[model samples]
Target: MTEKMLQQYKVWDAPTRIFHWVNFTTVILLLLVGTLMYFKKDLGITGLEAKIAIKEIHVWIGYVFAINLSIRLLWGFIGNQYARWSNILPGKSFPAVLSSYIASIKSGEPQQFLGHNPLGRLAVTLMMLILITLAITGLVRAGTDIYYPPLGASFAAHIAAEGVDPASIKPYDKTGTNPEAYQELKAFKGPFGDIHIYVAYTLLAIILLHIIAVVRAEITEGGGLVSAMFSGRKTLAKKPEDLN
Candidate 1:
């Protein structure tokens, strides 16, 4: 075979590549919005209007994040081995692999794999669960209020007035008229709001660690691990004996 033909290999499928980048972008955006919401008080931004505007952006972006996560999860099951949930979780042979990895570490030798190693798999799984929880909590907090307001002048008029009398009333106008409903909305949002902030911080730490691990692998392994992830090709062994 020609050198180019011998070098041809496929690693990440198209769907997996798309999912990886999409999740990366959404995670970064979510972190930014979360930070703004968490530190809004300390930032000393004046007026309820500004605060509400920030929150609206945060909540809507959260909805988009949730949708992206759901699509990724579905793709994981239907995608390639590397992207599958089963690949991340330890299987029946995990004990032997774990032992080999531990022994290699103690002997100052490197363990290699085409897919995520044990520790990397664990981190990926944990990050996915945390993200899913954050998305669900955000949806639960927002969907209820957006679809059905508990108090205020009544979304009833806003719903009817949308096309009939656009200038007649506003959504917040209804909230202003119903103090009790507004308090109920606040009660639902407060606790989950705190949970979301803490989860975001945890995810940030995990992301930093993940990047560090990738950098270390690229430096030590000489295998172009990072580029392999994007290009779906790695340096092949020179001989069958070099295979591990």
Candidate 2:
């Protein structure tokens, strides 16, 4: 093979790699803490203590994820062409690109790209929305009763919908118990909390599928799919015709 033809490809920006791993670790940690809280198991403390600590950790991680997501969203607007949101959702071109990818996969031929493919882009977008909702709900739940008293009362009913009894906790007096506000908050909070949990589970499933797809591509396409995210290099085909 000619030297030029045998050369490998380089892709994936350093910032993107860092974001990927950081988000991965944060999600895993959140899952662990969430599981403990949902099950009400005494992970390492008494019943009440364990519940309190797990909830605290969950809230803190929610904040961390939210900040990281905001940074990523900003980066998407200003980053390289491959990283830009426009590249992923380029008007009507998105559907065509997505169809091409599906066709390539079915033909046992994977198309190489410098950045996320159409389906990948869509998945990332959905994941971001889900994470945002998760963070906002968690913040409202936390601030409602534990950290800030006045604000907590406003969202008391909403907080309770997430399986937390805002009234049971005596952190503040019932000085401004507006039943209407309480009921309104509760009505929204309850259904939103359930939706949040279900979406989290869906996110986990998507993550697993993403990992599997990467592994499959690496094996079949003879490309360093995983390492490319880390070291940003792909093995080149022996000849131009080999691209097929």
TM per candidate: 0.76, 0.77
lDDT of 1: 0.66
Residue by residue across 124-199, what tens digits does model 1's lDDT show?
8888989998986676555433432222224333333234442343434452234564456557667876787788
lDDT of each: 0.66, 0.67
Scored against the true structure, residue 233 in model 1 reaches a CA lDDT of 59
